[model samples]
Target: MLVDSYGRRIRKLRVSLTDQCNLRCHYCMPINAEFMEVNRYLTPKEYGEIIAELVTLGLEEVRLTGGEPLLRQALPEILTTISRCSLKKISLTTNGILLHRYLELLQQHHILDLNISLDSLKPEIFTQITHGRNLSQIQTNITLAKQQGFRIKINTVMMRGVNDLELFNFVEYAKSENIEIRFLELMRIGQACQQQQDQFIPAQELIDRLKTRYTLQAQAMPLDSTAFNFITECGARIGFIASESQPFCGHCSRWRLSADGILRACLLKTDGLEIRELNHEQRLAAYEQLLGMKPYLRPMEVTHLMHQIGG
Candidate 1:
């Protein structure tokens, strides 16, 4: 087993398929973003090899991420490769814009757990946050995925002046749809760092606000879980990823592999071990090095963007 000095066991791996995304969310990307050359991304075969090795080293779950994973042309092939490994669960994080095109294929690969990013329910607000106009289509896709028996989780980054007023709206949606909605605090990373102060909202504040209307019972989660979850009086589930106010770094058991095959032990750290050019034995050594590099607490700031670090 890959255990760090702090005794945190590495059990999950997050892989970025590409740095390309269709929507230019202000917090995640710049208005005019330039993507890496296609050749710089790790190919499906390379991903399969690395993932197979990581599984042997004690990785039980793999989550595919991206600037937008669905934008990758070879995503189906990548999914097929990952499905061949021995894993307890396989998941993907996407914006839900292209989910309709790959729903059947994802089910075929047994990727039933999905994290969809949706900031707002209103058309204008959604476009303002994401700089895209697919609110209606994404909502339809979420419903379709639910009907198809997929476990869906909605991720919303709560910005104070932006969409903080929609907290109750999201809670009601969660109750009506019987799905989990996770509100994430704005982090000091990349383009988001510039607006973190003006937009940040602490998780405690959100919880206090919810207590006014509903009773929330704390839910038990894995020690390594990032979100602190709760069940509402109405039976709806809600969660908070309060990376800023309530950090979970001591229990973090995951490592990230960027699209370019750089392995990062901490999201806030800018430097990582590049293993794309390493052989099997060398890659194993690199993993060992990374395990020792894991920090016991969250860093004050991260120079890389969430997408660059495979959020």
Candidate 2:
């Protein structure tokens, strides 16, 4: 295993395939955010080479993330290429707008695990949060994905007063759909900083609410996992990523790679080692530098936004 100086074995890598997306989510991307040029990001072959190397270095899971991974034109090809890597698990984190367009391609590539962003179930509120008009389409595609044997995991960023009222609604939806749902605490980074202070909601609040009505059985999850998993009374699996109220940095065993090849040791940190132009030996040295600099815990303040850091 690739153990850092801090003794955290780095086994999972979150690779941002593209820093572009179709929707302008309020908490993730800024309304006027400038995206990286397409050519500036690594190509599929380059990603394959790097990922293959990482896999050999004890990387067990690869999760392709993006501003919206599905928006990348070469997504199918990219998935197909990365599928060649000797990794235990492969997944994608997407906004789910273009999921239907890539459903067949995904199945062809055998990429099944999906962590989809769905902040709201109400049409108007969904539009308000995502600045997109495809809530119904997203819902349809989610259903389709489930029908096609994909393990669906819905990720909801809970903002106070914005969609906190829909907490029970989301729980009910997850229960009815028989899908795992995780409520994420709104981190004070990037576009989220521009949001009103009242908009921020702690994961503890939701945990308290859920506990009031149901029995929450604490369950074990993967290492460096951000979420605290629980099995609810209604058989719906639920989780909370309380990064703000209760930091889980001590157990963090993963790292993030941006589209342009910046290696972020921690999401709360802005400065990172850029490995886009590095050679093999140089890249390995840079990785060591990042691991050496990895903090034991995140600081009180965070300035980088979700999209900028690769959510």
Candidate 3:
């Protein structure tokens, strides 16, 4: 098994296909920063090559993410290539705006698992969270995806009373719809910090709410994960990704590849080696070096938003 300096086996890679997003969520979207210049970003070809190499080094799983992955036209070819390599799993986390249009193409290319980010169940709340995007369209897209028989995971960030009280509503919806829900703890970052409480809710608090009924087991329990993944008594799966309350740094085996090809050593570490800027040999050597960076037990407060860092 390929291991990082922390002794955490590197098995999964989350690749950010693009930095440009169709919607501007209040939390993740930068207020006034210039986006990555199109010419400066890595194209699908270069990304695929890096993924191929990473797979040889123990990449057992790959999740194609983006500001919205469906924005890229070359993604079908990219997914097709990775799926053909027989990776254990290949999934995409999309906003679901463009999913309806690409549903068939996604299945055709062997991309099955999908993790969609949806924070609100109420239409007005959806509008509030997503900044004016039509909730009805997203709802239609999700319903259509379900009918098409996709292995879907809905990722919702718990914001205090905003979406927290409605958690079980989503859980019930998932149960009725035969879908899975992953309630994530809001991390401190970009637009996330603007909330009075930073809108940061701890994972245990959510699980405690769950404990009122279901027997929950924390998967890959790292203290930092505050993101506990659990299965219900009747076999329904509900997960929590506690990135802040409990730091899962020691067992963090995942690495993120940004649109510009930067290898983030830690989710909180913004500066790491950039693959595009390195020669082939130097790139490999630098990758090895990053895998050898000192592991932190007490991690610093994270400043990068998940969208920017491909969380």
Question: Each prediction's Cα lDDT score?
Answer: 0.93, 0.86, 0.75
Please name the candidate that would achieve the greatest TM-score relative to the true structure.
1
RMSD of each: 0.7, 1.4, 2.7
Return whichever of 2 and 3 wins on TM-score: 2
By summed lDDT, the worst window of 10 consecutive residues in model 1 runs over: 302-311
The sequence of per-residue lDDT tens digits that candidate 3 reaches over residues 1-311 is: 45765577777777888777777777777545356776766776677677777778887888888878788767776676666665788889998888888998888876778888899988878767777566678778888988988888889988986777897788787777778788887766656766726477888888888788778764565542334667776666788776777677776777788887888767677677788866667877877887876356735456666577775
Backbone clashes, candidate 2: 2
Q: Which lDDT tens digits does candidate 2 get at residues 78-121?
A: 88789999889889999898898888888887789999999999
Quote the lDDT for 174 in model 1: 79
lDDT for each residue of candidate 1 in 1-311, tens digit (9 for 90 to 100) = 78988899999999999988889889998878888899999999999999999999899999999989999999989999999999999999999999999999999999999999999998999999989999999999999999999999999999999999999999999789889999999999998999999999999999999999999999999988999999987899999999999999999999999999999998888989999999999999999999988889789988777777787
The top-ranked prediction according to lDDT is 1
Error of 3 at 300 (Å): 2.9
> Which ranges in model 2 have alpha carbons more than 4 Å from their true place?
none
> What's the distance in Å from true for residue 159, model 2?
1.0
